[model samples]
Target: MSDRNPGMELDLEWVSRVRVNTQAVLKRAQQIQGRKLVKKQWEAAWLLRAVTCIDLTTLAGDDTPSNVHRLCLKATQPVRYDLLKELDMHDKGITTAAVCVYPSRVADAVKFLKAANSSLAVASVATGFPAGQTPLETRLEEVRLAVQDGAREIDIVINRTLALSAQWEALYQEIRQCREACGDAHMKTILAVGELGPFTTVYKASLVAMMAGSDFIKTSTGKETTNATYPVAVVMARAIRDYFLRTGHKVGFKPAGGIRTAKDSLVWLTLMKEELGDEWAEPHLFRLGASTLLADIERQIYHHVTGRYAAYQELPLA
Candidate 1:
């Protein structure tokens, strides 16, 4: 919709040749995480950037309108006002990039944001999120329904079966259809890397998703037994780099699931800056699909500004 990264035709041959060196990926991940920490003044700035890139999320079995409203309010003002003021960032109008919810809750998020007079985007996970085992038509229809319900961003899962079987063309076509169904809303294709076997498969799936017109390539759904890890992120980031080299399009990358703690946010932001440069560090190009991560970030920021640890209640429920 924003015309940021219009997808291109699937090049199966190019995709087939994709390979990843597991050892190199693991070593790089370690190096990135072990790199000198951003200290004092600069650390706070990096955390603030992380706040902007968060897709503040809530997806659970018992998610209600009440909780969803609370989540929306958190998304509207992720860090407390006093914390922002202490950090001298209050006038920056800081907010999370978007609010991610299940398909059923998309309208609730939209309505809440409207009532609050906030322009935050709403992202809904569809197409049988987490597993993606539904019929193809059902999946596409799910996307359409979410769009009609006022979701500005659609986070659809890729059929892991297709990727596991090396069915690159089939997977590409499926994602292409989902993109069409998304219409103007930005489409984020979740690779569910944990189910896809190895780093090579993750790399290939990332390429195929980009080729098929995914506005963003997400690492996991947060429902898998094993969710996002640094090794997996390194592979996906390299894949994004390769995609940019072959095609002029810049596809965004999101590492969802198990990303808690302010340190986690800093590591991810550093990864983006190192792999994709400064541009990819922005919310439009990178997102941390997290709910609890926000609380940790708030706690860290409060500590950084005030030099005192925040009580649990001091941070908002995210």
Candidate 2:
């Protein structure tokens, strides 16, 4: 042992290695296919840390009254409704940040969600959803209806046709209108990254939406065939992180669609942590728009906390 304390030497060595590894991971990520977009996925791993909730947005299609009622009861029937709650009581995992639902079903979502936790937000889909091809007027109306119905967050898909067409002006106007329609509600502009031409287009669209006042930039609606990818998310995250660095305003990110496993969530979380740091970890800043992903995370947690595999039926569902 040198003059320095052995413990001090170990601490310094560990810190140095952590710095080196973090830098290497980030640099390697940047060189990857969607390197520019992987920031959030990596950052989320460490930022918010642990498991995050994913709203399976399209799980209930064409929200008719009966369907809405059923979903409402299912989402907010109380954890006490869960048999597992009988034995131990505490805030289980992370509380779901929002109850995502269709615009027409916002009111029903609001009713049950409020009963569960008043602060928990109600998010609604709008602006032509998966296609995002509706006329601007129709899209605005969609947003209006959702807000009026009590949705505090609105997710609108970008008009990819215009984006791919390189009609930045048209795309900018559409997002601006959608943002305006949101009024006080949080506006998340979905780039539909997979179908939006290229990662470069994703970056430009993200900038345009952020300029037009998007509170968050989402990767997909979880309805698209290609949904979200690590590369696409990397591009979007870099844009937001860089924007914050230059403008002093932090924006949120949501990588929706096709993300369904604890490992998948971990990949995004790792991206977020490595790219954006800890500030973006909370539900407010980072969210995985997944419907079936949470249960898997719960299962993993159960296994870790207790030494046995958690049975499927025994686990609670949102």
Candidate 3:
């Protein structure tokens, strides 16, 4: 596991002077998909590993204890038992990295996970997630409330308005407060990249978040018109690497929204391995913020095992 970053004083010089070569980032991202594909058993193995790094999520307005129970069940058993047996991986005890939900559902996720006797992390989206428009006090209270409810990870969305206005100090302090409220809970800061205009600001936002004690710097909230594009992720990866070099602290990276295919998961894993090395490829350091991704991954695993794709009905719903 990568070492936890305790955060550092906000460095305006580093944050303000950050730059991202848009063309170079875009070119590298394009090349990731072009890399040689992992096939057969190796491909299956990678997909399974990817499953372990997924933040299984359900953030809909209609979410309740019932569906949250199902989400927790899926997290504990992401792959079908029979499918795992086919690959002789049943004994491996595979599970998703965590189950993510709205702050209100934190207790339900925690309750279900405990009943299952699983210690899988329960991540809550706090601080007015998806928009971060709530007042600062209210948002901080939400973070504390989620932690009080047993969320082990808090995915906080940064105020894009601050980033857009270049409020570096305010952004840094705000995230620091969220980190403080998190206490022992891990903090994953969502930069909402799609809304943050330009590659340079994306890079800077990544830096400020890491310096503010974000355990993971996420690509988006998955609610924007554009989410988790490769270019934006590549930029974030560079910042994570740079931070690691300077502080000897490791921060994880998560890409949410529009990532829903087995092949797509492989591409993301490949990106992490290439950009951040194998250390960041593990479940603790790398996570895919996805809801529909597991189904597709399970389908691919089924096809690989049986040489025939299973219909959607054959696999259990998440």
Question: Highest lDDT among the candidates is held by which one?
Answer: 3
Models sorted by TM-score, best on top = 3, 1, 2
Error of 1 at 26 (Å): 0.9
Residue 236's lDDT within candidate 1 is 91
Candidate 2 accuracy as lDDT: 0.66
Residue pairs with colliding backbones in model 3 are none
List runs of model 3 lying over 4 Å from the truth. Answer: none
Indicate the TM-score of model 3.
Answer: 0.99
Measured on C-alpha atoms, candidate 1 has an lDDT of 0.91
Q: In angstroms, how far off is 30's CA in candidate 2? A: 9.1
**Poorly placed runs, candidate 2 (over 4 Å):** 1-27, 30-53, 56-59, 62-94
Worst 10 residues of 3 by lDDT: 13-22
Question: Model 3 over residues 129-204: C-alpha lDDT tens digits?
Answer: 8999999999999999999999999999999999999999999999999999999999999999999999999999
Cα displacement (Å) at residue 161, model 1: 0.8
Q: Each model's C-alpha lDDT?
A: 0.91, 0.66, 0.94
Candidate with the larger TM-score of 2 and 3: 3
The number of clashing residue pairs in each candidate reads 0, 25, 0
Using all chains and alpha carbons, the TM-scores for the candidates as numbered come to 0.98, 0.78, 0.99
